[model samples]
Target: MPRTREPFWRRLLAGTLPLLVWSLHFAFAYGLAAAQCTPAGMRPGGPDRALLGAVTLAAIGACAWLAWRAREVPRREDAGLLDWARLVLAVLALVAVAWTGVPLLLVTGCA
Candidate 1:
């Protein structure tokens, strides 16, 4: 039988996209707040709330997409360990994204 081909982007990140996006979210969320907390980080107005909000939404969207893609993978009894690994990794990545995002709801600023 002929082997099925995954999309180029899918093949590039595949099972690790959620974690990658989460890393980006973390950098933007905490990193931005931390920067704003500093005296020189800004002119004293405060961290950019709008910017952070946008970042949070984008991160969540990416993680949700990753999880959706993971669920699209077929679950066959005959599937091998590698196939299983991809699904599990994607799920784990989504979990990581969620855990990292909870703070966004409760903490929204440098204060």
Candidate 2:
């Protein structure tokens, strides 16, 4: 049988969301560390930093869900195991964000 093709948007979302999430995650992590290390006494072990992390993760999760639902539309059936794996990873990542994010936020006073 011929291979199916995914729509442009579906492919775009699938490719972009994870990257966006990861970048945000890393940026926040590093940002907090740097901010804390600066002369400003701003530390990562505060509530505000933790809140930022949690919020960032939540946003990532929401975006991933949106992407997943979008993929369910009339997109091409060419989606393979890898495609599904990526989506699953996105979800798992979101969960990780929540798990680690909440505590971080609470401790950091970012909440």
Candidate 3:
């Protein structure tokens, strides 16, 4: 049987989605931290660690889901470039999200 090819746009989207999520998470995390630390921007009580943590977890979960879906069913022996790309990118994003969240555990308050 011949291998079915995915559309160019779909392959591209799957491959880039993980990286995009990672980038967004990076920007949001740092931006939130910076904003919270600023005297004028700080929340009434303090930093919102819970919200940040929740977002981190959600990002990690999304990346994991993408990676799992990339594996696909039927267990093909010969996966294409897009398949590999999607799996690799998802795992990379998962690690990046986790690493980015590390400061949340170590740091408390803006000080």
Candidate 4:
């Protein structure tokens, strides 16, 4: 049986959401916090400890969910080879989120 043509947007969504969220989380949670705090003289702690913590947690959770969604992209008989690459990206995204989040825990802000 012939496979149906999947749309490019669908493929991009399936592959990139996790990475996108991870990047957003890293930039906003850490970079924004640091930038905000540095100017305001928050020093060792950026955008309020609670706010930073919440952002970090949210990022991790979102990335994990995205990774889960990516992992669900069907690896069965009709699965496209791109599915493998997306799954890998999902895993990498999860790692990126965790790696970026570690600074929030360890540094508590910018060092």
Candidate 5:
């Protein structure tokens, strides 16, 4: 039997899930940092930090799982232009993460 093709939106979602997960991580990290530094009595090395750490780890795990599932999808030779656009956006996101940490460390003098 011939394999059934996945819908366009479903395929797009599969490819984009990693970006969504990483964006959520960035937002959560920024919010956590702000919360820690703000004058709200929420210390950095407390229960809140622990909770955020757990949540972040779980997000990472979920992202990995989604990526694996995405890889299992059958490739199409005739994707629409929009699909190509989404793939390009996903590549840019991956590149952003790859390059961001080094500059972040250099600017912050963390290295």
Candidate 6:
């Protein structure tokens, strides 16, 4: 059976959504850390690790879902560059989110 063509906007979104999500995650994580780790009120611990973990997990989940959706494209003979890009971007985003989240787990506070 032939697949219906998706709109260009939709195709572009699926291809780059992962990177978008990753960028958001990166910004949020660092922003939160910086805001909470001020010298004025040097807390005993670092930023709110729990909240960071939750956001990281949510971002990872989003990336994983996107990657799963694009999984079949790699197996299709007619798949184009955008199709491959979608899968690659999703996987890259997933790894990036995980890697960024690691420091939150290890670092205590602004020490």
Sort order, lDDT high to low: 6, 3, 4, 1, 2, 5
TM-score for each prediction?
Answer: 0.66, 0.53, 0.84, 0.74, 0.54, 0.89
lDDT of 5 by residue, 4-54 (tens): 688767776756766786687667655655555566645534225455556
* Regions of candidate 2 where Cα sits further than 4 Å from its true position: 1-16, 41-54, 57-60, 63-67, 70-78, 108-111
The backbone clash count of each candidate, in order, is 0, 11, 0, 0, 0, 3
Q: Which digits, one per residue and each the tens of the lDDT, describe model 4 over residues 17-40?
A: 777888888778767666766756
* Model 6 pairs in collision: 45-109, 46-108, 46-109
Evaluate candidate 3 by giving its C-alpha RMSD to the native, one decimal.
3.4
Which has the greatest lDDT? 6
- Give me the overall lDDT of model 3: 0.85
Residue pairs with backbone overlap in model 5: none
Report the error of model 2 at residue 59, Å. 2.5
Model 3: residues >4 Å from true position, as ranges? Answer: 1-5, 43-46, 72-75
lDDT of each: 0.67, 0.60, 0.85, 0.73, 0.54, 0.91
lDDT tens readout by residue for model 6, 12-110: 988999999999999999888888888865557888888999999999999999999999986799899999999999999999999998987678869
Q: Which 10 consecutive residues of model 6 have the lowest summed lDDT?
A: 36-45
Winner on lDDT between 4 and 5 is 4
lDDT (C-alpha) at residue 85 in model 4: 66
- Report how far residue 53 has shifted in candidate 1, in Å: 2.4
**Which scores better on TM-score, 2 or 6?**
6
lDDT of candidate 6 at residue 97, scale 0 to 100:
96
Question: How do the residues 1-111 of candidate 1 rate in per-residue lDDT, one tens digit apiece?
Answer: 766676646555665565677787888777877787787776355667677767777777776776676674576766555456567766775676667656654664455
* lDDT for predicted candidate 2 compared with the true structure: 0.60
Task: Please give the lDDT score at residue 7 for candidate 6.
Answer: 81
TM-score of 5: 0.54
Worst 10 residues of 3 by lDDT: 71-80
Ranking by TM-score: 6, 3, 4, 1, 5, 2
